[model samples]
Target: MQKCIFRFIRPQDWFAAINLKDAYVHVSILPHHRPFLWFAFEGRSYQYKVLPFRLSLLPRVFTKVTEAALVPTREQGIGEPPSAALGGGRPSPGFALSRPSLKVLCRPDTKLCFLKSTVNASVLLFLDEGYVKMYLKGRPITMYMPRDLVDTYCLEAKADLPPKKLKLDWVYGYRGRDCRSNLYLLPTGETVYFIASVVVLYNVDEQLQRHYTGHTDDIKCLTVHPDKITIATGQVAGTSSDGKQLAPHVRVWDSVSLNTLHILGTGFFDRALVCLSFSKSVRTNSNVCFCEKKKNRFLFSCVFMPFLSLPSQCSNESVFAADFHPTDANIIVTCGKSHLYFWSLEKGSLVKKQGLFEKQEKPKFVLCVTFSENGDAITGDSSGNILVWGKGSNRISLAIQGAHEASVFALCMLRNGTLVSGGKDRKLISWDENYQKIQAVPELYGPIRTVAEGRGETVLIGTTKNYVLQGSLDGEFIPITQGHTDELWGLTVHPLKHQFLTCGHDKHVCLWDSASHRPIWTKTLEDAAQSAGFHPSGATVAIGTQTGRWLVLDTESKDLVTVHTDGNEQLSVMRFSPDGNFLAIGSHDNYIYIYAVAENGKKYSRVGKCSGHSSFITHLDWSVDSQYLVSNSGDYEILYWIPSVCKQVVSVETTRDIEWATFTCILGFHIFGLWPDGSDGTDINAVCSSNAKKLLITGDDFGKVHLFSFPCSQSRAPCHIYGGHSSHVTNVNFLNDDSQLISTGGKDMSVMQWRVV
Candidate 1:
């Protein structure tokens, strides 16, 4: 059938088709072949009558016989060659007929479009390529698929191939909100965590990161195998880029090689895979116990083979976390809203028993669970209490009340047997074997979501605000990984250093070390930041806010030196003159506010405002001499301006002779080729030229970054395109040396550092 589709049909071709109803009954099998279909059932012998269902040779045989009969119609030019029994149900053959009367052959309610067996001709009927790919793949093309096939089939693709010559050095975000078991300290000194559709393996000691670009949507849960080398991560269901529904599933891979070993539950799980765990015992085969969002949707499956399931009578609680017993693979514990279940496998059947609170009141939710060295189940509840349940009794044997100031979110047992608990109160506390408080570290930045032990006494904490902190038992916890919580667009590179600053709608302005992919300092602002720029001396940086308020800060001390406002709107672009004499602040109010720089950018005075643009200013680049500027606006207007005179230059010939300091203008003559065909002139959001002026990189609305030769003057310009950001690539910038590139995601709230190879 596929061969027939390829031989006769093209995606662009259309026609009317006829489906021969009960077409298989039209052909009669020979007596000798009919005996082959004989069957005996319930002590009764049944002889073959018609073609049987699910016969492997039926489609081929029926298609051959039906095509022979339809050849006469094709010879008479009445129709094209017919395709018989495409669906194979009852030999409902289809023919593409050119006759106008045959157009109504397919009813409106029919799933398949009817086509006449005639010459390939145009018609009003349409078929989407996404559906064609879905039909070819023989399944729904949802959120999670291989990266290469995503763009062609997915409805919402969040993962794509990294750019050639551009390696994704790090992802500056952590998925911690309402997720658990997501942070792990692997044996190789790599910290495993996930953000968006990518799993990041960051090594704190080396300041390096490796990415596992597997999942296609938002990751919800992660777990490590007993070997500490194998890892499994799960993602929530999402639509593909073309709107195909993707199922929630888990992926197991080697942490060192970063090779996927297995993908579990593509079509089996629903809603989301909340949590998963690896059984400690692997003598026979590794087993994984996982739970999902729906009621009683739990499965105990082997990593390589068949699966066991819990009875349907199980509780309908939303499972939050699951763990296998340290010594017994059959013993599993799952915790969720107001319920703690102790599940065990016996005689190839699964059974569960509820853990009793005894004299203690039941907590609202059991947020996390872990196994102790002595085969005890330690569970943390929403009431800021920790309960220890005996393996035999399934009842709370020890209770530690007020272990934290707020609801306990995570509990971890270190190698030295020192138990640590983190909670919504922004505190990390340590307890001794007797459950007595040892020490408490308070004043954390955000609510702790998950906790894992690092080297020695240090513990890694995953926070709800997308932060991963590393701290010792007696020291302060410093954030090792941080990301914006809202849309981000502001991005600027240091003039002379391998450093950059980013700001976003989350109100955070962060100075980052581009080489290490780590934040050096972060300051929260009252209003969301929209644009940023650094002075040529790299001593002071200006951060523009959404409300037309801009602040210039001393780069060294991060001290605010000045604050000024133009109209009440967002500042879309901020650029400083290469000579360090002027600063341009382009606002959404359709004005560019120019300021004179003095005292090495410590002081600024209003020079003049460039106002001829009819729409909000989107981008601008100053000439090297600082006399002329080119700007783009939201209304697709590209205009040249003279900042000193605050006048728009209308002569194209005059502007063509000017040498610009930057080539970021999207609509300029030298770079007109940047716009693809059918584009409305706003597809490219940001453009940056390399320091050497040899390369131009662009960030577009579809989360793609393309690097083209400088002065791309040809339409449909050839370029090296890359994808990593799951949202719009709001901004792109290169380091002063042009050895590194940075791109910011708008809605994914991530900063991706790319190394130029």
Candidate 2:
């Protein structure tokens, strides 16, 4: 140690050093031997699944593993096994490690440093095991090799593929509040939907999802072609983050190939495309009908017909749905706003006739329309009635009264003449040719928005609360996708397990399992939630509301233990001290409320308030010893405080070197390089550091999550960026083990989970 220290005493000498990420975790304890590492912590029994850092045997185990991995390289004259410290005879300016293995190769002109190994079969085996244990729970450290280095060092390179890089594992949430028919049931057993701009096709039985990311703005409506594989989806008009105009448009694509077949209406549609449908009669050249928000204008075009808008008398009435006659290609039926119109194609112009109610009472609206096997028009109305119209009369011939308890929203005719109807009553009902109710499914999670037939007696339903459910006539329904109904903000990770908690503007607090990518439990509060944190013991969680009310709930029982209000404004962030003795609540009123925790986090008492910021408090972190705090505010202020005295540290140098228990303040000196090349102060919304202190992640206003090296000091620091959210990313959190990350979207109402690959 003395010799190594003396070698670096000369100020003129330059040196480089590297620290292995998650070093001790690479060493695993055998299943039977794992029990030997067991201990009691806060009345809970725990055992190490991997070699703990403080274990006495960790050094020898790590060294043996490193040596075994570098044995193959040693034969090629690599200098030596990695040493605890290195001292060079001469001054060295810089060094590079072509290979990550711990074999040290020093020449007169170059010196390679030690780092985590990504080569050799033994190291690969350890990584594979770690992947299983830490999968979807921690951020993974990924490394890449240049092509030339792979060919020179790894002879069997093609046969030995490197470990997969960390990537997005899953995206949560559904977009349904403002759109219609967003969910479609494909014949390939894939339920199709869109969140933000990306189209997602999910298979329920296999628990898999594939995405089609072709649109730039939020998708508004979607329809499946008659052939069942082709799909046409439309989007809203808006400007992207880079000032690019994302015009309203329709994209027709092949679902199996996921390739865009045709992009239509790039500059033609106005505001948004509200409805889309494909003609069934035109087999060779499929015709499409597009409804835009401009005075309910309807455009029709196909291979044989010119793109033209049909003339309408009630231009102010909103058209909810339009369909080509099942047997007549020249006839179109449109229904909306107390009016149903029939139009006939004639000499490049269209003639329309309004369907009259005659002696019957006129319904407020006709929500959806389908056709029977006999080509009779079947329409569902706002009064929960099904009206069968004659093809020739353009009038209602029969009315099935009170088919649903509330307004009917969707209708589908099965191949066997069975009609399925869904509505605001949250019921899915089947009717025979006689319009008699055959079966009624149990009430679902939300009001039904759309319905489509599946195999046999099964049906697929899209609900207002942003869920897709598949069920049989006998009422066994399973949710294929579920998401929040409003904007999401709060995110927190479990202390020990692969679980997390999220709360959002929808007034729902959800606990999710990273392994399954689904919610484990959900508790609803009276107000929307903005911030959340798990106690150190993992027994209780603290949730802060938009109205500044905060509550503590039992993690296991999900029962509210206690509740309190800090201020009238929102609680932006909440964090517990590393030692679990105190909780800090950051509020929009520019105050940090400190509370002393007792009885394992169920009880709390006011400690005091830290008040030094001029703007709203955005984020805060506790010092390692829980005696000091660092906080960021909306106005880009970074201040340190001694929470014990509720006083600010007047001297910045006194707290400059303090090691924080966690790193989350966006304006911290260590995270200065996380900002983009040209960014406003508010571009980044949230920041989190891995528990290992090796990685830092940021969620930004542009719907991006960036991963950077911890304490990124370089200007324009290089990082990995991922995007799935449609709106601003509100919060990001790394799990306790640093194996996974969770991000929430503000307007998209979505949660996404990422795995370190």
Candidate 3:
């Protein structure tokens, strides 16, 4: 059941890989859809500023509203989607057009027939008749029937002459009859697949048998081993980082058990990995071999970024496509910004790497690549050209200019040796082996993102909008559809392993190994928890509650290590000092409480309360040396406190230590979260493991999260509003590598995990 969910997705439906930007916040509910979403909270009957997450039909509602908004834009010249190219199976005309892949089937001999016997001969002489014909095995066997059969046949069979039948894409199935003992493996998109555990019964709805998940990003590339028992998947990183680019991850899993065998992270700061393929020969360990005795994993990474530039401001060449050599298990070719790198999987080394652009020519990025059966390297570039290179050769063997009006996004070789390419210009072009452009299919659903060869000389086209098109040289086609079920709120990625934790008002904290995307365990809490953070050691989790109580729980046991009440009101903030020596609790009591952590965090004792805040403590962070504290309050005032003094830092009689340090938090989820400037935001809730990079993160009512590089003065601070939240951002924390930022949202009842790169 855990693994079967992945089968819902058709493997090449790339458009389904969506990272919704403030999803619920962007969906405006109509008056008709508003009634069910209405609710009263916090003594107010406030309707949602955006669509709430609790609605059962959010997906349908969202899709309907979205289509409504895009209708007018349709006239702007995008053509009708080809009805024939849709997958599933072509729906019968005028049947309200359901997806073709889900029809039901019934026994053939159950046809409707009607006939009556006139035994009375001369007594009225009125008779009606209908004939029935049935097929046995592929031959037709006719049977005469009475016209009265309408009353004798099942209503379901009479109303519909034929039973519904569902056809699936990517089934690439073998012809067989003893299917009861057979197994089926299917991809669910991204980092997951389904393993059919029970014998499959045709046309019958079967519960998901098993599922496996591990990839953290979209599974843009997939390869099945020759044995068909092991599957490899490549993940697509969302984007290169603001200040630096990072490489994406790849993994190999056993199709039988759905267990991950290896996670491949070959290089760092490279472009997002978009394509993958497997070699024909089974790999064996050799002396210079990069793989282990069991399997081979190779990584290809790109380089450093523009120094001092924000990750958003910085950019680099990235790998948009790659594929393995047709026969060699060791050779792989990758293309990016005007360059190609030939890598040896056995040694994890680049055998040949170089830029492909001519010195006097304008540079162009290669968007997709493929290998011919003859072992030639072929690529499609942004400049609208198809470039071919000989096997093991770096020189361009042939170049066909202006292959498409816009950049090409997909390329694949069919069994007949014809090369097909899809481009952003909405054109699909076919080229002969000698490089002559012969035909074109224009005005497709959208620009293709990827393509795969299908049985019977057909092709699967994954589009930019997440739809798939069944492409054939003779041109006959069907449409396939795929989205998240709930709002996400709290997200924390594991430090040492490829695991992460997520929790929300769903009342369950789900732990997952991102490499598998399968939940290891889920714990339902007794009450709604407010904010959460992890200790520096990654061994414990500290969560605060609305009732002014907080608990430090062991990550391994989920058992309370310590639960304490700080004030009469909510304890919105809980943070552990960088050294793990102190735990800070900021509350509604107009003071920040400090506790000394001892016995390796098993115990805590009250140190002293940092007082003098005229109002509730809004936010706090420790000094780099851990000797003093900086805090902000509800009155738009910031104070410097020497914890050793248990009071405000007073430097001299003329002027107290009224020095400015840095702004706390980003804008709040509430509009009022911003200060007088409307630009600089404020929040009563903020956190700081306060690392040496002088960086701290804050979230607020503005539904925004900001990262601050400190040593900042009040006049100006170097910061970035990093990511989005649907509602009030309750807390923000960094993972071990600080490559990803996690946050929890309040009211929205969701948690979203954002990777820095």
Candidate 4:
């Protein structure tokens, strides 16, 4: 089965983007293919009720469904019902067919009209060769971003390129809709966007994992060191200090640690240039600012950062670009405001300085710089010229003039000895050894601010705005970006489909299709969601928040069905039982509250509360039979509770209700309130048990996962100790087969999936 790229459908195609929502999932999975998609983990076996990932001919199957879906809308003015789950399960919400059935496939610039709106089929779809050879600036081209990105950054594309239609001649039977969709109608044929290609490359994958996210502020500049083991990032400046604004900070981070190894910037430079003072009378120091009847003083401390230039009253340009030495990662060159400063990375002190222009020449703001493979420095100046400087030299050895018509904003040295320079003129020119332009491309969206070498002949070009594209020497470009901007707090894989939901402190809950590794949709909440769990039947999702509020959301509509507010504290753990009758909420208030799921989980009522733990609850899980509740507390104690009677199960079988609410101390509490102490003081942050109800696993603060046999006491030793996580494990989950475990790192941003025997 062959598949057509959905994004390639021209604007004039049969329906708008709104119709194609979850187009493929609408195709019913054939009875025979369901068995091949079965997955088992931690002793739980699951079969895909809908189409799963990695299925052979998946695109073709989805395309067939799309073709069938569009036919009814085009011929009869209505869409056919989804055939995938007609008899039982819920069809994808994205595949909602309408009468005079208009289907919006993806999120375009605006909401597409459904039944109320109809597009004329008399208008034909335009064809683009899909790419342009090269282009110049002053001309704007619009690129059709991904189906759901809602991006329409009009970039100037295709300088000196002609308009050509994609002509296909088929003498035999033709099934594809490239030319036949609008046979009699002549398309408007406006150039939507221009693309380029090199090395006979195909289309962009769009789902590659390449984003490096951590910084909260914008990245003013960055440099990959010569060793390729370290990267230095200069951030956009933060808040002002002492009534005076400071430059952005520079952070050096090792590839191994992924953390800032050192910080350097404006703290050292403005020592004596400016002393901002308020009207005050002080006795301790004149530099201090304070006011009082007798004497008042406010003190300020000044610490110097190494190698930063002493800012004079006249010059205060921020350093936006830097480059590491060709042979040594320790040596770096920084250029800003016409001055080139060389510095030692180890000592953080200036080694030398060279002026970009002559003594009488006006100062030119140097915006970008790079190092050639041969140890020569190449800098792009504001004058649209490329200046080449030799080692230990103050004068320019070679200058490439008339390289660009405007300010040269970026420079990159490709591995093939070709020098690439981009400027505000929208021209990306590649120069040979003699500095003559071999090829020029002006099909960029904005002014190129910086360029870094990527895989092979490709280079990562960043615009002045928040966009970066992977461009090849031959001019093909692919955008590599992010899906999430913060650390993930919880992850839940759907039991029925190839989808999962991830929540983060960023207050965003993102749903992703595991097969494509692409985000489906992201919904932002008012408060941070600490935990997310899908119902046993995968129809609804339960979310617990830091504000002690729990929500039951319809999985399809993502609409809140009900909400229950508990004791005002963080509800870190929310779990739905296998039978979907009870919801367990673990809170920081040292209490595990139970809610009886009713009306098919539309609303929940508090049934009972199991309190008595000395410390806050860290993690909780329901027993396989849904009779017992097991929870781990911060004080390294695991407790068992009988939810039916709202009581703790101890050896003594206490019949009386123990009101420990008034007893604040642990020693004064009743013996039945506490279970056997677990973990020997090793803080357990995450815990889970096997489906067989035999083995219990706990991930502790010591970076170890311990497995213990059930029905044991404090004197029992763990049956096994597995170590893998480098930091404290924040979450632990058992797979369906009960043979493997999934653990998430606290700070590493990695989810480890491995087997533990």
Best-fitting candidate, measured by TM-score?
A: 2
526, model 1: CA deviation in Å?
Answer: 2.5
- Per-residue lDDT of candidate 3, residues 1-757 (tens digit): 2133234434332111112121211222334533333322222222332222233323433321111122112121111111211011222333321222211111111121111111110000111222222111112222222234323422112111111111111110111111100112233322222111111111211322233445433343455665555665554343321213334555667776767776665353243333444555554321111111112223432111111111121114555555567777567676666666676543444555563555324346777777787899888888888888888776778887888888877787876888888777767777884555433433334455555565566665555533345557567443221101123334555546656666554345656544333456556565445545566677777666556777776777777788787776755455566567787776777877788887656688878887777776666655545555666556534565665445676442211222222223321111111111212223324443332334556665555565554422111233455333334666556555655545655543333444553
Better of 1 and 4 by lDDT: 1
Instruction: After the best TM-score superposition of candidate 2, give how far the Cα of residue 453 lies from its true spot, in angstroms.
Output: 1.3
Worst 10 residues of 1 by lDDT: 133-142
- What does the lDDT come to for candidate 1? 0.72
User: Residue 620 of candidate 1: its Cα lDDT?
Assistant: 90
Candidate 1, residues 1-757, lDDT tens digits: the string is 3333335443433432323322221222333323233332223223322423333333323221111122112211121112212221222234222223222222122233222211111111112211111110111111112223323432211222223367777788876765787998888899999876788998888887899987767677888888788888887887643347878888888898999988888887877878889999755468888787775477888876644445333457767888889988888888888898888899888888988887999999999998778988999989999999987669888999988778999999888777888888877888885755434434435788888999877889888888888988787788888888788999999988999999999899999987667778888899999999999999999999999899999999999999999889999998998888889999999999999999878999998898787889998999989888888877656677888778888764566567788887666545655655334345678888887777788988666778887755433467787766656789999889988888888887888888788
Worst 10 residues of 2 by lDDT: 128-137
Kindly list the per-residue Cα lDDT of model 4 for residues 1-757, writing each as its tens digit. 0122343445555533223222122233334423233322233333333332234323323221111223213332222222212122233334422322112222122121222111110000111211111001111111112222123211121112111111111000111111100000001211010000000011234322212233323232333333443444434333221123444445555544455555654453222111111112222211111011111111121111244332222124544344446565445566666566554433433344555456334337776667776778887777788888786555688887767888887786776878888777766788875655533433433556455565556666554422345667566665442223334457665656756676656576766554454456667788787788778887888887888887877778788788888888988778776678888788899988888886667768788888988888766655556666656566645566777556776632231222111111111111111112221233445555454545555655544555655322111233455543434656665555554545554533234444444
**Model 1 spans > 4 angstroms off:** 1-164, 238-247, 269-271, 293-296, 306-318, 346-359, 392-394, 434-444, 475-478, 516-518, 612-614, 666-683
lDDT of 4: 0.46
Rate residue 143 of model 1 by lDDT.
Answer: 12
Candidate 1, RMSD to the unseen true structure: 16.3
> With candidate 3 superimposed using the best TM-score fit, by how many Å does residue 367's alpha carbon deviate from the native?
1.4
Q: TM per model?
A: 0.73, 0.75, 0.34, 0.43
- Stronger candidate by TM-score (2 vs 4): 2
| Residue 248, candidate 4: alpha-carbon lDDT | 45
Report lDDT (CA) for all predictions: 0.72, 0.72, 0.45, 0.46
